[model samples]
Target: MKKQQFVCTSMIPYPSGNLHMGHIRNYTINDVICRKMGIKMFMGWDSFGLPAENFSISKKKTPKLCVKKNIKSMKKQFVDMGYDIVWNKEINTCNRNFYKITQFIFCKLYKCKYIYRGKCISYWDKKDKTTLSKEQIIKGRGWRSGSKVVKRFTKSYFVNLKNSFLKSIIKDIKLSNWPETIKKKQINWIGEEKGYVIKEYHLFFNNIKPFNSLVFSFNNLVLIKKLTKVKKQLNNIISNKNIFYKRNDFIYFVGYKIVYKKKLPVFISDNINFKEFYHPFVLNPFSNIRFKRKMKRKILLNLMFEKGFNTNEIFFKRKTTYKILDWNISRQRYWGTPIPTIVCKNCGVYQERLKNLPVNIKKVKLNNNSDIIKVEKTVINCHKCNCLSYRETDTLDTFFDSSWYFLHYFCKDIRKSKPLDIYIGGEEHSILHLLYSRIIIKILNKIKIVNFKNPFNTLIIQGVILNYSYYYFKNGVKNWIRKINKPKKEIKIYKKLTKMSKSKKNGINPYKYIKRFGVDTLRMYILFIAPINKNFIWNENKIIGCYRFINKVLEFFRNKKNYYYHHHLKYNKFIIKKIEEDINLCYKNFKFNILVSKIMTEFKILKKHNIKNNNVLEKFLNNLYPICPFLVKSINNNFKCQL
Candidate 1:
C-alpha cells in the first residue's frame, strides 16, 4: 500500500541566530505530532532577514555566511534530539529559488489589483537606521541593539485585503481541524462589526476646541480640570501608531464612539458608503479593561466598547473592525529579501516585474559601527517599463518570508505553488505572524495566484517553554543563579514565567540539558511541564522528576510478569478506550500536559501485568512517541529484548 502523504511545516526560525528554549519547545511539539501521525514533515530556515543582516554588520560578515553558520548550529540541535526530519525538503528563503517563488506570489497579487502601495507607520530604529516590526521591536527596546524605537512612517506595499475576503476565508475556519481557541482568535481578529459613524477627524485641535457643546463622551460629574484637557486626551488617543496612520482628510476610521443616554448598546463606523448607526451589542468597555489605572482608564475602556470589546466571557476579546494596519516591511540593514521595488528616473518608483522578480541585488557588509554600514550601489532594469531603474535598497520585511512560509513547503518552489496540509508554530505567532500569513494567503488566492484561500488546513501552535531563572539580587548586587542550587527565597524572584531569550538570560541550551539528562528525560519534562498551548516554567526539579519517572517505567517493565492477550477484555477495553480518549483530547484540545499525565498513569496502572504485553505496550508507547520518541524506542526494544 502506498503511504499517505501529509505536508507538515515548521515556520522556520531565522537561521541568522541561536535557538532558545522556546524554539526547542516549538520544534519538539511539531516533531512529536508528525511522528505520532506518521506523516512527512518539512523543516527549513527563515534565513533571509534582520538577524543575518545585523550579524553581517557587527561581524563584518555576509548575511549568507552568517545564516549558513546559524543553520548548521540549529540543524545539529534538531538532529541531536533524534528528530525524524525531511532534510530533502529543507530550504532557505534567502536562496534565489525560494525568494523568486515568493516574488512570484507577490507579482500575482499585484497583477490582480489586490496589492496596493501605501504609506504606514513603523518603529524606527535610529541606531540601526532601519524600520522594525512590532516583533523586531522588543517590548521596551529595539530588538537589535536595545535602543528605544521611535514612531516613523515609510512607503510600503500592502495586500488589499477586503472585508469580503476576510469574512469569506475566516467564517468557515472553525470547520478546519485546528485548535478551537486559535480559530476563535483568528475569527475575532478578522473582526467586522458594521454600523458606526465614519468620522474623519482632521486633528481639529486649533479651531474646534470644545465643539461649543457639553462634552458628551465623558460624564459631566467626572469632568476634568478643563474641557481643553478632554481635547488633549482625544488628541493623545491618536498617539497609538495604528490609529495615527489611518487618519487623513479621507479614509474615515473604521469605527466611532457611540453616545447613549442609557445603555443603548449600539456601535457604528465606516470608511466608505456603508452607513448605519446601530448594531448588535458586542462587549462593554467597563468589563474589558477593569484593570486600568486612573484618568484615561475609563476613556480607554469606553473606546474598547466602541471598538467591539465583547465581554461575553474571558475566553476571547470582542470583535471590532479589522483595524490592524498594513505591514511596514522595510528594513535598512543588509541581509533580507530586497524589497522588490525600484525608483525610476521617469515613473518615480514601481515594483519590478515577475520575470525579474528577485532583481539581482549588490551585497554590502555591516561594520562594527551601527550607522556606518556599507550600502549597496547598483542599478537594475525595471521589469515594469524596461526603463533604467535604481534598485530598491530597502529589504523586504523578514516577516514577509516568515509569513505564509508553510505554504512554500506545500509547494517547495512557491513559484509553482501547492497546498499545505498543516502548519505548526508557537502560539506566540497567533496574532502577528499567523494573522499576517492568513491575510497574505487570502490575497494571493484572491489574485488567482494560489488555489487555496487559507494557507493551513490545520495549525498547531505549540506552547512556549519558560526558562525560569532564579536571579539573586542581594543588597542591590545582582548575581546569576541556577534553579537547582538557588535558595527558595531566591527562586521566588521569578514572579511570572516568560519566553526565554539572550536578554532575559534565562534560556538554557537544550543540547546541554539533553546530554546531562537523556533525550527521554528532556522530552518528558517538556510534555509534563505544561499543556500544548500554555507556557511552562523550566526548573531542574522538573527535569529530575521526569528522569525519575523514566527510571520507574523501565523498572516496572523489567520486573512485571510476561502476559499476552489476543483481545482486550472488560477492564482492558476500558483502559484502551480511556487511552484513545486521552489521545484524541490531547490533539483536539492540545492538552499535552494532561496527555503526558495520562501516559504516566496508564503505565503505572499496567506495570504489574505488562512485561510481554507487546500489543498494549506498543499502543501505549506509540501514544508516547510524540512526547518522547527515544523513551518509546527504548521501551519497545526492552519489551522485545532485542537491544
Candidate 2:
C-alpha cells in the first residue's frame, strides 16, 4: 500500500528583519514534528506585510527589495540549522506568480458573491492613513504605528460572513482536531448570542421626540458631546444636571431615559461590555447583576409585562448575531497583493480577466506620491464597454495572502485535489488567520476549486517565547531599559517576562545564540526548555547547560571502550524499553520537553550500565537524530557506525 501522504506547515514569518528566538522556537518545533513523522515539509515567507513596508520606507529601499534581502538572510539561517524543508515547494507571497494565484482565488471568491463592496465600521489608523483588521489592532491602537485607532465608516470590499457560511465554519470547528482552547476562542469570536428581538417604542421626555428606543434601568444618565442636538434637549429636560465627560482612553457612557407606559432608564456605560442591542437606546441586561440567563429572561419578561405589553404581543423568541464582523480585505498599502479590480465611471466594478492577471506590482514605484491605480499604465479599457477604467488602488490585506497558502502547497496544479495534512501556527492566529483560512477553503470547495472543506486535518499552536523585560519610569515616561543596564540612584525598576518582540527591544537574536553554541545545541536547548504548547522563559544559564551536554555526549562517544557493555546485560533491556516508551509517547503527543527529559534519563542509565551494544546505541542515536540532526550526523560519521 502507498504510504499515507502527510504535509506540514508553519506560519510564514514576515521578512522584516533577522530571525529571533521566537521564530527559531516555532520553526524548530514544526521541524522536529515533521522529521519524527518522516514527512516532507514546505516552508515559506509571509513576505508582504506592514512591517516590510515600514522597514523599506525607513531604509529607503523598495518593500520588495527589503523582503528579498531579509528572506535570503533568514533562509540561510534555516539551512544552517538543518531544517528538513522541501525548498522546491517553498513559496513567497511577494512573488508575482504566487500572488497571481492569490488574485485568482480572490476573483473566484468575487464571482461566487462571497466578496462585495460595502461601507462598514473598521479600525482606522490615522497616522498610517490605512484601515486595520481587528487582528491588526493591539490594545485599541495600530500594531505597526502604535497610534491610537479609531472607528471609522470606510467604503471597502468585505467578505460576506453573515450567512450559512458561519454555521458551516462553526460546525467544522467541532469536527476538527484543533485544540479545545483555540476552538473555544473561535466560538466566542463568532459570538453567537441567542437573545430576544423585542419590539421597541419611542417615548417623549420634555416635549423632545424619542426615536425607536429600548428601555432598561440605569443609575446615572450621560450624553456624548458629539450629539449636540440631543445633548441640548437632554440639558433642558434634566435642568443641566447631566454630567459630560471626554475620554479617549475609555468608552463614552452615552445614557438616555425614555417612558414607554412607565419611565425607564438606559445607560451606555463602558462597563456594559455585552453585545449592543438592536435599538439605539438600550441597556445591558446582564450588567450589575449576577443572574443566570433564565433568570435574566424572566426579569426581562416581567419588565415587558409591567410596560403594559401582553405575553403574546412581546417577541421573546431568540435571535443570533455574530460579534465577528465581515473581513475587510482592502488595504491602502504598497507592499501587498493588488486587489484585482477595475472601476469605470460608465461601467460598474469588474474583476480583471484571468489571462491578464498578476497585475504586476513591480511596475509601480511605491513612493509617497505614486498611486498605482491612477497610473496610465495600470488603467485599462473596460472589457465590455471599452471605457477607460482605473485599477483598484487598495491592495489585498496580508491576511488574504496567507489564508489559502497551505492549500497551494498540495494543489500545485490548482486543479489538483489535496489539502494539507497538518498546519502549525501561533495561538494568536486562532481567531484571525485560522478562521479566515477556513472560510476561504469553504468558499473554494463550494465553487469546486478544490475538494477539501477544511484545509488542515490537524492543527498545532505553539506557545510564545518570552524573555525578561526591564523598564524604568523617568519623569512620567516609561523607558525600556536593558537588563545589563543597571538603573542609578535607587530608581524604582520593574521587571516582567513578556513576549519577545522587536518593538519592546526584548527579542533575543537566535544567531547570537547559535554562534556561541552550535545550531544543533541551540535547537536542542529550545526544545528542552519547555513544553511545546506552554510559554517558556529564556534563560542564559540553560544555554550553557545545553552546550555542556553536547560536549559530554561527544566525549562519551570518543571514549566508548571504557563505557562498553554486553547486549545481554539486564539493565540494557530496561534502558531500551524506557527509551522506546518515552519516544513513542513524545511522538504521539508532541511533548518535546518530556522527550528530552526521558532521553537524559536514558543517558544516565546508559552510563550506569556502560552499555556498548552497537545495536542499542544506534537506536538511541537514531531517536536523537530528529532533534539534533547535525550532532547525530557528526557522531555517526566519526564513530563509523550506521545509525
Candidate 3:
C-alpha cells in the first residue's frame, strides 16, 4: 500500500524583528499540527512591504539590512522552539529569485489583458508628502504623521475581474473548509446585487435599443455634435465613482441596460438627474426604454420640470449580478514588488518583456522617490517608439506579493501540488488577503499557470490574542501608561483589554514566557487554555499549571525504574486502540484542549493497569508529541520508550 503524504503551510511572518504573542500563538498552532500529523512543513518569509521599511526608517538604517537582521533573529527563535520544519526550502519575498516569479505572473496577466491601467482615489498625506494605505489611517488622520488624510486622484493598475468571474468565485468558495463568517465577508465585499428595481412606466420598455450616449430629448446624432461644443458646460457632470441615483447627486448619462442578454441600448439614467435632463425619465426608479420623440437641443434644456416626471409604482424580479470593482494594486511605497510596466510618450503603457522577468528595484532613501530606475541600466527604451521611456515607479500593493506566495513553494509542479492540504493564519486576513489570494489563484488557473483551482483545501483562522493596556487621556490626547503601579480600581476606567498590537503597546514578548517555562510548556499552555479559534487573554497566572505538568512528564521519561521487563501483549493492544480512538476524535473536532486533559487522565489509568509494553508506550508518546515534545523527544531518540 502506498503511504499517504501530507504537507502543511503557515502564514509567513512580516519579519518586523518584534516577535510578539500573536506570532507565538499562530506559529505554535502550526508547529503542533505539523508534528502531530507527521506532515512535512515548509517555512518562508513575507519579507517585503511597509512594516520593515517603517522600522528601518526609525532605526536610521537601510531596509535590506534591517530585514536581514530581523530574519536572523526570528529564525533563531523558531529554531529554539524546535519546530522541525524544513528551513532549507525557505523563500523570501524580497529575494530576486522569488520576486522574479512574482513579476513574471504580473507580466503574463498584463499581456492577457487581465491587468489594465485605470484611475482610483488614493489617500495622500499632506504633511508626510506620501501615500498612506487604508490601514495607516487612524480615523481620518495618518497614523505616522498625524496629518489629515485627503483623497487624491491618480492613474493606477487594476486586475480586471469581469463580473462573470466574480459570480463564479461566489459559488466556488463553498468547496473550501473555511469559516462561514469569512466566506460571507468575501461575498459582501464583492457586493452582488440581485434582481432589478423597475417602475410601472418603465414598461414602455418592450424592445429597447439604447445606442444613444447623450442627454436627450435631443436627436442622438445632433446631441453628439452639440455635446462637443457644450462640453465645458457639462464638465462637472462627467461620470465618476460618486455618481449614483439621487436627484441632486445624479449626473444623468445614457448607459447600456445591463442585462443577461445583449439587450438594446436603452435610455438608462444612473438614478436621478432629469431636472437638468429636461425629460421625465425619472418617472420610475429604472424606466423601460420609452422615449416619445426627439426635440431640438436648444429647446430640451429649457423644458420646464413642473410639466412631468413622477414615479407610479415599484417593480421587482429574481436576477443575479455582482457590483465588485476591479482590484487596485498600486502603492507609492519603496519596499514592495515593483510593477513590471513602462510608459512612453508616444506608445503609451507597455509591459516589460517576459525574458527580462524582474525589473529589479533599486533601493533608495525612504524620503526620495524620484528617478527610480531598473537594475544598473539608467535608461530603458520603449519597444514601440525606441525613445527614452520611464519605468513604472509605483510598486505593487504588498498584498500582491502574498497573493501567489504559497504557490511558489510548489512552483516546479504547481499542478501536482493539487491544493495546499492545510493553511493557517489570522482572521484579520479573511477579507483582503484571503480574497486576493483566492482570486489570483483562479486567474492562474485561467492562464494555465496552475491546473488545480482551490489554493487551499482547509483554512484555519486563529482568533485575536487580547490583553490589557493601561492608558489615560492627557489634554485631549490619549497616552498609553508605560509603567503600571496603581491599583486595579484606579486604572479601571482607563484599562482597555483589546487585541494585542504594537500600536496599543499591549503585545508581550513570547520569549519571556519561554524562558520561565520551557518551550513545550508554553506551546501546551496556549492550546490547553482554550480552543484555538477562541479569543482569549494571555494570562500569566495560568503558566505554572502547564509548567508543573511538563516537569511531571519529564520525570516519567527520565526515570528508568518506572520501566519493567514484562510483556502484556493483549493488554497493550487494548490501551493502544483506545488511545488512538481518543486522539482521532480530538483532532477531528479540533478539541486540542481535551487532548491534554485526556492525557492527564490516561496517566492515572496507565499506573493502575501496570501495562509494560513498548508498542503501547510508542502509541501514547507519538500522540503526546504535539503537546509535550521535549519529553517525547527522548522516546523518539532512544528507541521508542521501552516499557
Q: Evaluated with lDDT, which candidate comes out highest?
A: 2
Residue 522, candidate 3: C-alpha displacement in angstroms: 0.4
Local accuracy of candidate 1 as per-residue lDDT tens digits, 1-643: 2333677667777664567677777777777777767775578887766556665656776778777787888888778777788887687888887777666666666667666665544567766677776555565467655666766446656656555665676765766677787787777655555322212210001111112111122211122222222222322444553312222211222224333322332211112111111222322221211111233544543434444332222233223334333455666755667666668887876666676666644656445655445676567666566788887677677677777666655456553565567677777677667777777776766566677766777777776667565555555433445556566562345433557765456777776877788887887777778766676676776688788888887777666425344444334557666877887677556677788888877776666444345566667766766777777677667665322
> For candidate 1, what is the lDDT?
0.59
Cα lDDT over the full model 3: 0.66
Per-candidate TM-scores read: 0.71, 0.83, 0.76
Where model 1 places Cα greater than 4 Å from the true spot, the runs are 1-4, 119-122, 133-147, 162-322, 380-388, 413-419, 468-497, 556-590, 635-643
Q: Report how far residue 5 has shifted in candidate 1, in Å.
A: 2.4
State model 2's lDDT.
0.71
User: Where does model 2 exceed 4 Å of error?
Assistant: 1-4, 198-228, 231-261, 266-317, 362-377, 470-496, 561-572
Model 2 agreement with the true structure over 1-643: per-residue lDDT tens digits = 2333677778888875677888888889889888888876678888886777777777767777788888888888888888988887788998988999999999988988889876545678876778988767877778776677876667788887754677778899889888999899888888664444442321111111242433342212221222222223323344544332222322332344335543433323322222232233333332222111323334444454444333245444444444566788989877789889888888888788999998888454545653222223367788889989888888889989998887667656675857677778789888788988888888889889888888778888888998888887776545677787767778888998888877666898887878789998898989898887888888878788778877877778888734444455556586579678878788778898888877777777767787787777777787788888888888877777676
lDDT of 1 at 302: 45
- Compared with the true structure, all predictions reach lDDT values of 0.59, 0.71, 0.66
